[model samples]
Target: MCNNISFLGPKGTFTHEAAYILEGNLIPYCTIPAVMESVSNGECQFGVVPIENSIEGPVGLTLDSLAHKFDLKIFKEMVIPINQNLIVNPKTVMNDITDVYSHSQAIAQCQEFIRDNEIQPHYAVSTASAAKSILGDKTKAAIGNSKAAEIYGLEILKPNIQDLDNNETRFVVLSKNDHEPTGRDKTSIIFSIYEDKPGMLYKILGVFEKESINLTKIESRPSKKGLGKYLFFVDFYGHRKDKTVQNILNELDGLTYFLKVLGSYPEF
Candidate 1:
């Protein structure tokens, strides 16, 4: 029932692109932190945020926000192919570029290219924003994508410059209500175990194994409330309606002090 959406942006950001792919519309916002806040406060009916990237790993801020501040549910998922491009102002060419600007993740994905080209990497707020900044400085280039280069009217010096060609980012659609299954689906959950206990994770994962369910991803984040406690977030490849997935949840329900079924949504 939720219609209005929001995402990390000043527009032209990958999060914005991911939102477009998920909702087929633009949800205006300025940052992932802002997008999560809007969903938590009901400022928007739904929000989209990048959870992980194939080349760069987890987005720590998004995971932490989901773990602590929000009671949000992920209603859908989207996998957007990342194609990092080296962009420069129309007046500037490849050899004239001395420094590059982009979000930290973008810089990380294009590390090899930057190192090999001897271009200094400067972290900007977002990829789209980096492209904007490049428009102001002729010597400064940016590492973003083709969409961003197009949006900023910058010339693409290089395309698909990411170290990995299979680079993809996973975005989650968040809302207050759970999603109905679309036959093929995926479920996301978050839980934690005692920091001092060994094999606790193995036993918890064994539940999924015993039920013959496949885990799509597993990641750990600092609890933030304290130094030692940690939280684990997992994505599994089935809907909650499936008997095997339900049984796996039933087993987990009795074993963990804290557990939350974040969502059951059509897997993309």
Candidate 2:
């Protein structure tokens, strides 16, 4: 078991909440990159980072880091249901809120609420940070989870304020080593096409199709090495140990300029 784990936090961020479910000594860093760096530098045995939100799509930095920076393995995944609430200092009332605050994603999730309430949206680095700032202000409110309100001793003015009732975010657990396959597992990989030519991507995808592998997710990110170049990240429902999966990866190696299996773990 990992003795120490780190996550993106100042306290009360969603990532911090995810870490609570895993057993470890919790350390909080201020940014996503910092969290990954802590795990890469051995400051923590594992790191928890948000990968994507149901409404917002893939987290760009986490995807980019997996492809370009740290050679870490995604050992586990946690799916959390997101519930954004309107919180405020005890003295603040709905009528008193002129400026609303929360993380950028939170703001996006609560667009209808913000627009309906007629408050200016102020973006904070984290929902907890926004909740913390409501300490002495009466004309401001924040959108965050119940944990943030409890930690900051604020009042929840409204509950379930997110536009959609079923909003969720997927987070991944990062570690230095890979795990053995469970009967049910998922593999993640990144590959760059040799050249941006017609059917180049289609031909690469054909290998997966021919093998009958089920792809769970696929996303492309800038390579950062050059313009118009991209690295494709994919999640498929099979372990690297499986013969069919192994054969497909072996063939994929010859089809791209570079191919890397990020990691595989039991499906969540």
Best by TM-score: 2
Tell me each candidate's RMSD, in Å, in order: 2.0, 1.4
Clashes of each: 0, 0
- Give the clashing residue pairs of candidate 2, or none: none
Best by lDDT: 2
Residue pairs with clashing backbones, model 1? none
- Give each model's whole-structure lDDT: 0.85, 0.90
TM-score of model 1 vs. true structure: 0.92
Q: Estimate each model's TM-score.
A: 0.92, 0.96
- How many clashing residue pairs, candidate 2? 0
Superposed on all Cα atoms, model 1 deviates from the true structure by an RMSD in Å of: 2.0
lDDT of 2: 0.90
lDDT of 1 by residue, 1-268 (tens): 4467888887888877777765434567876778878887877888898999887788898888887778889888888899888898886777888999999988999999999999999999899989998777878999887778888788887888999888999899888876887888889999988666788889999999888888988988887769767888999988888888888888888777678889899888
How do the residues 138-207 of candidate 2 rate in per-residue lDDT, one tens digit apiece?
A: 9989999998999989999899999987799999999887669999999999999866466778988899
